[model samples]
Target chain A: MSTEDILKQTPLYQQHLSLKAKMVPFGGWAMPVQYESIVAEYDCTRHGCSIFDTSHMGEFFVDGDAVKSGLDFLVTQPIKDMPLKTCRYGVMLNEQGGIIDDLIVFRIEQERWLIVVNAGTMEKDERQFQKFIRPSEKFANRSAEFGKLDIQGPQSRALLNGLIPDIGQLAYYAFDHFDLLGANVLVSRTGYTGELGYEIYFSWDRTPELWDELLKRGARPAGLGARDLLRIEMGYSLYGHELEENICPLDAGLERFIDWDKDFFGKTALLKKKDSLDQQKIICFISESRRSPRQHHRIYDQNQELIGEVTSGIFSPHFKQGVGLGFVKKELAKKGDTIYFGDDKNKLPAEVVSRPIYKQGSLKS
Target chain B: MEVVDHYFYTKEHEWIHIEDDQATIGISEYAQEALGDITFVELPSVGTEVEQFEQCSSVESVKAASDIYSPMSGKIIEVNTDLEEKPELINKDCYERGWIAKLELNALEEQSKLMNAEEYRNYLNTLE
Candidate 1:
């Protein structure tokens, strides 16, 4: 059988087809890559507003004490201190300190919590959670019961306020249950794009209704193509690209999200590699032109010696240039260094810059 | 979709408009549509000799990269420099403004090996 025949479909599959979306296999699901043109959709998301079907992502509900349930030690972040209605971003690691998946923990209440993870790693993450959590604690994979929509861009607030009047009260990284289209659902002021955005989790079957209502409210439909570009522009780490099984959070430049004050899973292994001299490094760069560096593209130093490989790349519509994330040696990844991508036959020059290549985004505004 | 009449096409989806010994080359609309949004186009340098059915340039989209093949053996005399800055022109107008290069043709008889407008349109249907 063909790959598409075996691939799963989201609830919004028909809606995407009606909009002429180019469906591509992603994370075991046949998802839309683009509705119209990728650049046009990207422009709409940056300057106006766009809604994306993020239902492929997985969500789980864990009920018990943070420490007693073993949830605190399963992830590399401090969960006991997370206030109600707030979200914390961190990674789950194996015994060897390798990243299993980067996820978001939402403290719904003092005892109830929600964990959102990548679609590709959902099964593996579930096995880890199931093995670690206490037998008395309740664990449920609610991915099939829910559908997610990411309404992103600067104009998202005004658009959402039309439907949910109290949306403005929720601060960044905070979530609350809100009534939408007669269903009470979780709505969070969070997004992957570096924009003032919100993510809505509604019933799976009724998601098409919500998607239609959002489109009817003047929000355009964007696909994973534009979403990838937006996230790359923000220097966000993708699961398969930046975070991998063999790569640790520290190597992925995510040490800031790790809490040293709290004891967590993989702490011992992570501490052992922390002070090592040859720890691998991840860097972000901006291309001199529109030519983008693709994943697995070779990264070379000024003298033409190979140093690393690109992990994620995109042609940034906002910056009108190519921006990328790559891994290089610790000694060669200094800021303001000129590096080249691609092979010797055709090398493109770029500069190593700080994280978040596009700073003009209204992320905080 | 938009196959220019009187133009010859290669199986690779490259369209060649031959006028006497001078020819112009561009990707077909079908090709551009399949590529989605074009971000960059590597234009062939001027005065480079290219063989028939050989890669002369490349186009990059948001998804992937693909090579553009020459339909006939020729010397690349001129290239569309505008594509360097705005590659989306190929997605917008693949037939006219998106033309990749103009060549001084060396083998005129090689045109018989390519498909005409009707045959190319039929060829595209097979792809679907």
Candidate 2:
């Protein structure tokens, strides 16, 4: 199908076009790939402030007690204990233990919650929630009613504080209701770029005004191309690439997010496969040269034996080198192991390193 | 999309300026703008023999990688080493400082297959 037919547009579509952004199809959305250049935008986000249009992501609102609403059994995290005005990152899994999607749960109030999910998996995620939580009133899929803008960088908090003073009090993984441009909105201190940033969820129609105001405040416009690079530099997994239908949370190096004490959809199958040694493993690597290892590129050991394949790769402007995250055999997931990444035409040497290759981030600051 | 009057162009968006038996080669401005911010370039080794319209080198932008094709059959006399550290030169000055390679022309007749400034301008119009 044509991208124009399947892909959706966000409220900032006109704004991106005004900046002459390079548009590309991403997650069934007509998203901007870059404004000036990906490298330039990446550098801007690392040093100054950058704004991203994240309105395509799905948002759901459910109203009930945490346990009584079947919310605790739907996700891998213990959400009942989450404080009001706080957000928790977790995953939703299928009965076979495979990941459905990774999501963030926002505790808006004692009886109200907002769940954000990936754009591509919105329909499936909504269906799964509907099937499992047979509530008196169905959970509201409010994805279309809201627009998301992410302001990220070292100076992100200060830049946003100048616009909305109350946002400065928000701690990491916390959110609060604030007034901006005469509208009450939800602002959260969370982001995917491993930078000190805030994600603002506002009324859909007000996005144009917010976009212009943020730009006037000197926030550079960043597109999906730089967004992917920024996230990969932090070793964050993209939904389809690193986490997929056949990949379980444990194999994806997300065991900490899964709570074994509570019962969930994929709990039984995950427990059965927990101790097994034969599983595809997720690992991060850094290239020896500036050459990047692209997605689906074959990863080999020092002896030239094929072991893994890259899921997401990019030339990190922050480090001036190439970094990638991929899945490999469990035996090949050791740190400090030498590896090769390439296609049939060329092969480049690399080293398995710890996740989040760029360590000097202001994410927790 | 600046096309020099004296240069000959290939369908792959490569431009060549031939003087006597030597030629300078680089991607067109249209090509560079389409590729976006070039981060890396894999240059061919000196003395490598290349055929007309064949792939000689590779240029990688942050978004994707593209093969740079040779406009005519020749032997590579020299490759641009400056691109290894600053591939952005290709985006800044594609025609001059960003010249990818110098080829010692072997067959002068291969120039007939390329388009002149006016023909290339019309050729680009067809693409749009």
Candidate 3:
């Protein structure tokens, strides 16, 4: 069979087709790349509002005692301190200190937890969870029966407040269940874009009704193309690019999210490699012009010396330049360092800048 | 899908309106639609000599980049400087306001190598 025939389809596949979305293969699923222009979709999310169908992502539920079920040790964060309605962002590591997946774990209740992971790594992550989770623990993969929609932008709060009651009360990274179109939906004050937004998790079959209602309420339909650009602008790490099986969280520039005070998977290995990180380093950078540096593009210093390779690159609609994340030699990963991308023949000038390149984002507001 | 009747076309989706010795060049509407939101256009420098079907300029869209080939080779006499600040004109109007460059035609015989309005439209149909 061809690629499209073998790829999975999300619940909103027909909706995307009806909207004339340009479908592309992503993470073993046929997903929309764009319904309109990518730049317009990006602007809608950053300035106005946009809704994305993100049902391809996986959701796993585990109900048990944190310590006895080995849930605390399976991830690299302090979940015990997380409030009931809050979610924590962290990674799961292999025994050798390699990243398994970067994910968000929601403390839905005292003993119930919901884990959100990347769509491409869902099967592997499920297998790992099944292996590490205690046989006595209750574990279930609810990815198929769930549908997700990311409503993002500066105007998202007011728009959502019109639909859900007391939506304004939930702080960032907090979530609550609400009634929507006769169905119970889990709405979280969180999103990938640097905006004041919400991620709505509703019943899989009822997703079309939700999507149509949101669009009817003036939310533009954005696609994965715009989502990738928004995440890059915020300097958020993406799986299969910034995080990999051989890439540790520290190497991916995510040390702050790792709680070293607690014992977790790969603790000994991480400790051994932490102080002696002499080779690998990740850095955020910006191109001097609109010429984008694609994935795997080689990074070089002013002296034409090889430094690193680009992991993610995008033509930033806000910055009016190309921004990217890359990994380079630990010594050369310095702020304001002038570097270049591509081979010596077509090297594009760039400057190493601080993370979260787009500072004007309404993410915290 | 706007194809100018008086213009000659290339298989690469470039169109040239020949007026005596001077020819104005721009991308087709089909090309602009495929590109989806042109962000940057690298216009060729004036007084630069080039061959027919040679790389004349390049464009960067929101998604990817593509090169524009010269429909007929000649020295670039003038370039659309307005595109430097506003590349979206190409997406707005690929025919009139979005012209890429003005070339001093090398030879009138080169027109025979390009397609007319009707031929170009039929050519586009084959692609779909």
lDDT tens per residue, model 2, A257-307? 988888899888888879788788888999898788889999988888888
Ranking by TM-score: 1, 2, 3
Q: What order do you get sorting by lDDT, best first?
A: 1, 3, 2
User: Candidate 2: misplaced stretches above 4 Å?
Assistant: A1-6
**Poorest stretch of ten by lDDT in candidate 2 chain A:** A129-138
Query: CA lDDT, every prediction?
Result: 0.92, 0.90, 0.90
Model 3 alpha-carbon miss at residue A354, Å: 1.4
For model 3, give the interface RMSD: 1.2
User: Candidate 2: what's its TM-score on chain B?
Assistant: 0.98
Separate DockQ for every predicted complex: 0.76, 0.73, 0.61
Candidate 1 per-residue lDDT over residues B43-116, each given as its tens digit: 99999999999999999898678899999999999999999888999998998999999999999999999999
Clashes of 1: 0
Candidate 1 docks at the CAPRI level of medium
Model 3 chain A worst lDDT run, 10 consecutive residues: A130-139
Off by over 4 Å in 3: A2-5
What is candidate 3's local distance difference test score? 0.90
Candidate 1 residue runs with Cα over 4 Å from true position: A2-5
The best candidate by lDDT is 1
Better of 2 and 3 by DockQ: 2
